[model samples]
Target: MHGQPPNILFILIDDLGAVDLASFGSTFYATPNLDRLAERGLVFTDAYASCPVCSPTRGSLLTGRYPARIGLTDWIDFGGRIQPARGKLVDVPYIRELPRTEVTSASLLRGRGYSTWHVGKWHLGFEETYPEQHGFNVNIGGGYLGAPGPGGYFSPFDIPNLPPGSPGQYLPEVLTDEAINLIRNRGDNPFFLNMCFYLVHTPIEAPADRVAKWEARVRELGLDRRTALVEGEFFPMEHKRHLRVTRRILQSDPVYAAMVESMDENVGRLLDTLEEEGIADDTLVVFTSDNGGLSTSESSPTCNNPYAEGKGWMYEGGTRVPMIAAWPGRIPAGSRTAEPVCSIDLFPTWLAQAGIPVPDRLLIDGEDLSPVLFEGAALERDALFWHYPHYGNQGGTPGSSIRSGDWKLIEFYEDHRLELYNLAEDIGEVHNLAEEEPEHTRALHQRLKEWRGSVAARIPTPNPNWQE
Candidate 1:
């Protein structure tokens, strides 16, 4: 409560794999904006989303509470086609409306005399539980649905996903426009702007011109158009049922890269707005992701890199993500740290940075990382845990993972499979050291059991004919 509260610009990317960006190492795609931003900020190599899926991770980011603790153990599923009896229905789970009781990042920031605006995708539930109700004074195009909008570039609204937004304009452009206007209007008492981009996620909608450019390139390479991607963008998987074709789509096509590039362009726009507003020095801009990449099938998949699973699973690839912080003079530019951080940690950290104390009643399960972020504080935790009792879109299936130092223990309840890995050596989780390291496995298992016992996780009804 000393100096003026620093304005915050929190940019969240969707389903972006670390390997896809040029700065992270991919020469296949060009992310000039992101590369430049990293050069002028702190890049975290070990930051993580608390959960492996979208809503859960988003909830953790905003509330600093585990999904399980807040009645959101699974991806926020609803809408779509629901099949009776079978239970294998398609729904928009990311739009799971949160209960009113939960305190959010927006409400806290707004209460601290900050002008708040939320743009881009708001997949956290419905309007009743919209960003406006959560804390933000201004919420743009947010809804209680799956996609904030469409994935196509030209007529992004055609998908009729997040149609409440301005018609006939690029979604990214719209989000940036709103953010810039808010900055220009807020004559300077310090503000909190969450520019959550819906880009690089999916819907495979690239501008017609961009799509044509990619097609011509792929054709030049004589690659089969079936799985061919132009070279810098992600094309939507044409079919929903073809799950096996997902990996083929990502590797064979350049659509994923293209989508990433589109997202990067918007990043530059937002940054330029900040500079124009002359608040760059006092703002703490944070860039991170909702979860991991698509890896399952053509219908619903995400890439998790060296890790085995994508979004829905508690694998390193799914939970671990990039966390870049830019605070002109405070944070060291071009520095990278591997200290483990979780999604829930964002709750207290943001409040602390804004000099606002989180109400004790919130009962957050996260630790404040402001000391680590500002004063080079130490991070010492016995282990970080995950408990996902429901299955989700990222078809990596359902499981819980606990990481302590280099050791990770994963429990797959539905299959009754328990596995352990030494992540320091095996990043892909290829080796199951549970048998060889029985003692450590036993200890971690007991810890998981004890932790699970305390949380009132929903017990999934057993299927009598599950084996059949």
Candidate 2:
């Protein structure tokens, strides 16, 4: 632990909920392997993703900068404009690729002589800007697409970076097998492997047996569509076009449950591989999600109950994600913390762990959590902020927010309305306290404004063609 740099095994899951795993209070989704992972690592109870979407949060993790600062504010859609039928404003143009100029954690680690590898989803950019351009020595499965191919999660994937497997082979299993091969083949140099899984995302497909198992479990629990239905409002983003965003109140989708199970099983496979290679004690492992569960669009698979909303809103469920870190003899076993941390913190934390000094020139928004990980110390930061200026497919409008202590404030750009909630008292964000708590709301709003100005954040502009 002192002389040699520890090998890093980072597992990032796409569209996973804060409560999707049994370790995170999910009674329905069976995830024993991830639960075992929690038992051996440090669980950050209030961990949050930078943005409640895919590309922005992923950018935050790799760059240690806020999405606004990096100019990757929205999910990459290959230059598509969101022209709602009767919208008041148009979305600000965002960068479609992770800039090659910005130095990444992979590059930093690779510069130090570590072997860096990336496997699975690389939705950050087009094919030319894949992980290999960012610092990975080996790249697999990462391509221009954010999700599985048109053929779905099974074999014969249409993705270019990944080769076809047998007829019914699963994507997560294939990715894990590649990771295991890397772990076993590495000679003596320490490695940094980013294993991002495409499970639990849209076009949810699973093995027939796994789907049947969950279907039977749902029937056994007497859960039906009526009992699972949860209401969600698509706030007025335009005049008349309102997309229905209904979420299953419980984690009851047989297909989604099967996907979760598959991810868990493959996680077990990677852990088993580490133990088999006799490097389990010397490796640092991380498990987290790119965003919250997809409970707003496409099938509305799993719900993030008690947190409010999911995937594309500025609620606890959408932004809050599950994070666990394990390094034998470094992070205490069965450790847990309630301090709020976000995805931007990982780069600095990992660099600190490897004894590398963060370069002074970079504008890193994240703080090192090494103290909290090793000594359970409280973070000394004052607040965290988020700015999403585009109408999301999952019912969220253009807005900016700030979370300070127990109070959170959101300022809607469409009408300049403010909503305040005391998260400690109301985690679901049911009661708006903006009117009752004027001074507190004003303070948070001012800070959000200041942050936006500091980052030179892009703002949506009013459309002249609106008839309203």
Candidate 3:
């Protein structure tokens, strides 16, 4: 075994909801690989992505800073400015890429002689801000495009940094091959492999055989039920641009189920590789997602119900995600914790695990969870914050939120309105106690505001062009 400095394999899934896998409580989608990993690791029931979307949370995972503090508050749509038709406000300007100056965890680890590599979705920034520029010695399929590019989960992905694969090759499967190759060639250097799978994201396409299996399973289980119409905000897409209401509440889509299962298989493959290499105990494998499920638009693939709303909304369904950390003898096997943790914490935690010093010049918003993972200790902090000043494609409005203990408060910038909920009692976030508990609301709001001031969090201003 590799003694104290274990190799790090961070597997980040895009748009995989907290409840997407069997380990997380979803019956429709089967994720045996992830479930096995959970059984051998510390499962976090209250892990969160720094943001509800992809790019920002990805940045947080890398830099250990909140997206708001880093100025990459929204998903980087380098294509152009996304102006919502008939919307009340225009999205505020945001940093289009991960700044070069920021010291990412990969960079820090690489400095300590960890051979760093990144595969799959990079979405953090454009050409100059890619994984290689930051720290990764090898970058495969990491690019600006969020989803698997044009070919959509198949060959001819046209993804930058990736060589062309055989026709009809599955994206996730191919990415896993790349990761396996890296592991096989890693030699004696302790490595850090960030396997960012572009699975269960967009295009909602999967191998025909896998789809057929899920389709049969769905029918056998009598899972095909009428879709429910959840009460959510109504917005405009201008003609056929967007759906007025979010509908797909049931996770019965055969295509999405297939994608999830395929991703799971690759996860299992990677683990099998580790075991074959006799490095399973010497490797610290962490698995989680950048954000919650995508239930609102773009095929309305999966649902994150019981927590209210899905990807893009400030609700738990949007930010809450599955997190598992395993290091054979270090992290307790089959252990579970309810201590709240977020994407940012991985930065400091990984550094702490590698015995690397946190850069004194860099400001970090995330705390190390090594104590929790290794010793079952609790973090002293009471609250976590989120600031997203831009509208989400999934119909979430611009807002900022603070979850303090059991009570959570969300302040909408459009009308300066506040909504509060006791998450312990109302995990669905259905009942608002803003008026019922004025003092609690005020204190949470004050904290949220103070956090914004401290991080220089950006807030969207009134749009003069909108009509009431």
Find the candidate with the highest lDDT and give its number. Answer: 3
> Which stretches of model 2 miss by more than 4 angstroms?
79-86, 231-242
State the lDDT of candidate 2 residue by residue for 185-271, as single tens digits: 988889999999988788989999989998998989887544776566654456324556677677789999999999999999999
lDDT of each residue in 369-388, candidate 1, tens digit only: 76667666668776888876
Worst 10 residues of 2 by lDDT: 78-87
lDDT (C-alpha, whole model) for all candidates: 0.69, 0.87, 0.88
Ranking by lDDT: 3, 2, 1
Clashing pairs in 2: none
Candidate 3, superposed: residue stretches over 4 Å from native: 81-86, 228-233, 236-242
Estimate, for each residue in 1-468, the C-alpha lDDT of model 3 and write its tens digit: 225688999999999998998988997888888899999999999999999999999999999999989999988877774643225655677888999998999998999989999999999888999999999999999999988888788887789999878988998989999999999999888999999999878888988998999889888877776653454455632322335656577888889999898989999999999999999999999999999899887767888877787898888998999999998988999999999999999999889888888978989989999788988989998999999887888888888999988889999877788999998999999999999999999999999999999999877766676654
Better of 2 and 3 by lDDT: 3
